[model samples]
Each structure stands twice: as structure tokens, then as C-alpha cells.
Target: MTLIGRTHAREIETLSLDSADTRNALSAALVGELADALTDCAGDAGVRAVVLTHTGSTFCAGADLRDPPHPDALVGLLRQIVTLRKPVLARITGHVRAGGLGLLAACDLAVASTRSDFAFTEVRIGVAPAVISLTVLPRTDPRALARHYLTGARFDAAEAVRTGLLTAAGDDVDAVLEPILDGLRRSSPQGLAETKQLLTAKVLEAFDRDAADLTALSARLFSSPQAREGMTAFLERRDPSWAV
Candidate 1:
């Protein structure tokens, strides 16, 4: 079964995260499939842009605890999105949390419906949003993100845009995306690629400088005693012992 559903229209390719049962979590399989799909998009001349979206109430609920990908793989996936020659945009209409925010930040543009909400939930699971910080820290406002990062508090679409996690938000997600898609369809392929390269230079730089350290941090924390307790509490639907 495919975790990503692909569709193309005009000059854009839409990749929908389709594992609604897992809230489209970043399992190793899902990450591999998405990377492969993006590579195909990069090589296809007919595809001028890529839209990353989801098919459920939650866009992505972070990494799949049952089958999480390696920290290195996640970092590579995030870097791939940032470095993909074709522009990648995110279209969200639901909740996004933890590692999902990394994917959003990696995209060139992201828009969502007002109904969507976001959070960096790794703290609740006794893990840092470490590897993802490679993409996230570069795109977001540090002052605003500090609170969310520490508390794992939920914020709305408007707040996401203000913090630089999303480009725009409205009551109607598709309506908000139409003009943006039209603009991408109108732009020359070479123009878009070069412009995207300019925009992502600093983000790529962050990946080069910090990805290894962050990936190590992520692996360490996830394997720690605190994370074990936290994950157990989460799976049991109870507050972690340290929650107090």
C-alpha cells in the first residue's frame, strides 16, 4: 500500500500524505516513499512545483513511535525538500505537530486553513525537536518559537504564519492556494529553480553545519529513560510522570 498519493494537474504535482490511520506519521516507510516521489518530481520537466498536503484531520502527528525513521533519515528528508530543484509548497487543513513542523518549514511556501493548529510536541515525549531544528530554526522567529518549543502548546494557523511556519491561512485552504498555484504555473521553470536556490541557501547552510549534531541529539534523547517513560505514558493515554 502506498503511503503517498500522487496527482498532477497543469504544471504542479500534489503529494498527499495518505496514512490517515497514523495521522500520516513519518514512519521509515513513509519517509522513503516521499523522498522517492520528490525525486521523481524533481526529474520530471512537466512538474514545475510540488504541493505537500495530507488527507485527514491531522496533517502529521510527528514520527511514528511504532516504526520511527532514523534521525539521519529524517534529516536527509528535510534537506531534500529544501534542496529540491522544483519549488515545494505545503497545503494544510488540519493539525501538525513535532516533526511535521520540520516538513512544513522545509517547503518554499506553506498555507493552511484557519482550522489548522500546530505544536512542537517532542518536549511532551521527553525528546527535543533536535534534528528538525535544522530546518525549523532557520525559518521561524526564535522568540516566538521558544515558548512553543518548551511547553508543547498548541497554536493556531495565524500564529504559525506569524512565526514563519506558514505563508498564509484562511477559512478555505484551496481558495488560499489557488492564486499561489497559478503564480507557480506561470513562472518559468529556470526562474523558479534559481529563485528557490537563493531562498534556501541559508537553510542549506544550517543543514550542513548542524544536522549531524542534531541527529545525534535526537537519537540519544529518544533512547533515554525519560523518553521511554514518556512514550509509555503517551501510548497508555495518560500524562507522563514528569508532567507535573
Candidate 2:
């Protein structure tokens, strides 16, 4: 079965992460499919806005540890979302973690349910949020990032908004998102595209300059003994040996 599903209505295309069994983890297959969908939406004149969302309680649990890291694919997919001619909106209804925050940051706008939670969990797994920091660091509050990135603590949707990770959060996601989508639909495609470029120029430049270095850092960390033990401990439902 396909890991990503697409639906369209009123010039808005919704790309749903369908891998609920994996909590919509960013497996290589899922990332590839999402990139393809975004590319299709970018070229479709009927599509004016794209909504990135999921079907399960966990929006995305981050990268799948069962497989090797796909930093290039993840970076490419984020680039596609950021550069797509259409404005992309993240419709978050559940928890987000680690690499998933990268995807969320790449969107032009994001609305999350107040019930949702978020974290930069890489440090706990003995890896740094290297690649994702390219997108996330620009948008998040420096103080908040220093705390969350170092502690791997979970924060609620309201904090996510206050930190600039989310555009808005409320008990009703659709209530918050529909109006933004409506505003986007009213905007001319050229207007949205140009405005998005102006907004994302720094992020795009960071990607161009630091993507390779960050990917290498990620690979090194993931392959380290500490990360191996950390991930193994997580899968086994225990703390890593290094945990004090």
C-alpha cells in the first residue's frame, strides 16, 4: 500500500501521511512519495495551496530507525516544499518530533491542534538536530531552541506557536486552518510565490550552504556507538547506557 495519499478540493491539495502503523515515520519510501506529490502539485495549475498532514495520532515520529538515514532525500523533500510555487501549509493534528519538525518548518504556514505536542528529540537519541536545524533554527526562538534542543523536552502547541514553530494553535485545527487556506485561495499564485521567496530566502541560502555539512554530521552521529545504544535502548523500551 502507498505510504502517502493525496486528495484535492477547491484548488487545495492535501498530502496525507498514510503510514499510521509506523506513526507516519519518515521512511525513505514515505519521503520519496511525499516529494513526488509535492512536485506534482507544484506543476498543477489547478493547485494553489498544498496542505501537509497525517492520518494518525502521531503526526510524525521522526526518521525510521529501522532503516539507514536518508539525509539527502529528506533535505531534497524539504527543499521541494520550501521552493514549490504554491504556498504549502502544515495541518498538524498530533505530536511531532525530531526530523518531523524540519518538515513542519519548511511550510509557509502551519496550524496545529492545541492538544498536539512537539520536540527536538535528536539529542536524546545521541544525535544532533543538524540538518533540520537548517530550517528550524531560522524560525524558532533562540532561547527556546537552546533549551529544547539540549534537553529534548516536549512542548505543547501553544509554546510551538510562541517559539514561531507554528503559525497558530487551537483546540480545533480546521477552525484555525480554514481561514488561512481561504486567504491563500484568494491570493494570486504569483503573489504567493514571490512573497514566499522573500520570506524563505535565508532558509534557502542555509540549505545551499550547510546542507552537505549537516548531512555529514548527521551520518556521523547516527553511526556512532552512542546513537546505536540510544536507538537500541529506545526500541527496547529502556534508557541508553549513557543515561545518568
Candidate 3:
């Protein structure tokens, strides 16, 4: 299964991406399963919060370029997470890249291991981070976004926090997350829901306004000649022709 869904404490729901074989890559199937799981959690009043997590060393290696890319699916999933009535927390235990960073940005809060790394790598593959920019650009530091989005350089968790992609980074992610979860548990469900709406109004507007165009842009870029060669070279473990 690409995703595993479970509820604990009668209130905390966890939807873990389990496609370790692909480093939990955002295949259409995985994204669909995630969307379904999140929808189920959203409609269940017993579920007060959702934890987005993954198994294996790589949290998510962006899109599975070998398969058809479905940028709309990712865009919808990010929207779902951001607009969810209950709080969504990302638990990162490993490396995150490209589209995965968008997932981190969507969550209301994220706690990552100090060893975890991140990058916005779409540009390296001849495509831009179009759809993700809707959510990521709102949270990321403008200067950091300019440098990392263009260079695709790997950055550490501390920088992730400083740039607003994460709430905290530590040796023990669970320890860092416990306090946040406890605080969430104390809030009334109605209060959380209303507060979340206040916090996410701008993001919802951005999604409504920009998702379609960005999704189209992502689709076009992925199908471009340069992207084809870049993806091919990446899968073959070689540098693209344009690499300096």
C-alpha cells in the first residue's frame, strides 16, 4: 500500500506514506490514497488532528517522473492539508526534496530531525516549482527562496526552521512534537477549526487564484525536451547535458 492510515488516542490520526521503494515518491496512486485518507479524517469529528509522515530514509523524493506526473493531484493534496479544519502536522524523519517541501509547507506545523535535509530541486530537472510555490512562497523567507529555488542546493533542518518550513528541528522529532500535540489536544475542536480558518484565509485565496495556472505550467515543463533529458539523466545517475 502506498499509504497507511490509523487513528490513535481517538483523536490523533496519522497518514503515513509507505512507498519506501520509491522513497515515498508522489506517484498518482500515493497521492490519491493520501487525498482519500485526509478527506476521511476531515469528515470525522473524532479526529482532532492529522499527522503526515513517512517510512524509510527519504521522506519523499518529489514526483515519480518515471510515471506520468500529476501536478494537479499534488496541488489538491496541499490545498486539502492547508484548508483542513483540524491541525495537520508533518513529522519528518528523513530527507525531503522538491514537491515534498511543498507538503512540509502545507502542514500547520512540522517537526523534523536535525539530520533531515531539504531542497527545492525542480529547477535542476528543468522544471520550476510552480504549484508548490503557492504554498511555499507564502511561508519561506524571500531571500532563501531566491537562492535555494534557483540553486537546488540541499539545506539543513535549522535553516528549514529559520525559513519557516518547520516549527522545530531536533535530534528527537517525537520529543519536539509531543508538546505541540499536547497543546493541540487542549483546544476545543470548534476553536481549532475557526482559528485555522483565520490563519489560512490568505493561503486559500492563493490556491483558488493560482493553482490552475501553476498546475498547467508544471505539466508543460515536465513534458518539455529539457525536462525529459534532465529526468532521464537523473534516473540514469548521470548529470544532465546542461550541468556545468
Superior candidate under lDDT, 1 versus 2: 1
lDDT (10s digit) by residue, model 2, range 134-171: 89988989998899999999999989999999999999
Model 2 ranges off by over 4 Å: none
TM-score, every prediction: 0.99, 0.98, 0.97
In candidate 1, which residue ranges exceed 4 Å CA deviation?
none
Residue 33's lDDT within candidate 3 is 85
Worst 10 residues of 3 by lDDT: 1-10
On TM-score, the leading prediction is 1
Candidates' C-alpha lDDT: 0.94, 0.91, 0.89
**How far off is residue 63 in model 3, in Å?**
0.5
Clashing pairs in 2: none
Best by lDDT: 1
Alpha-carbon lDDT of model 3: 0.89
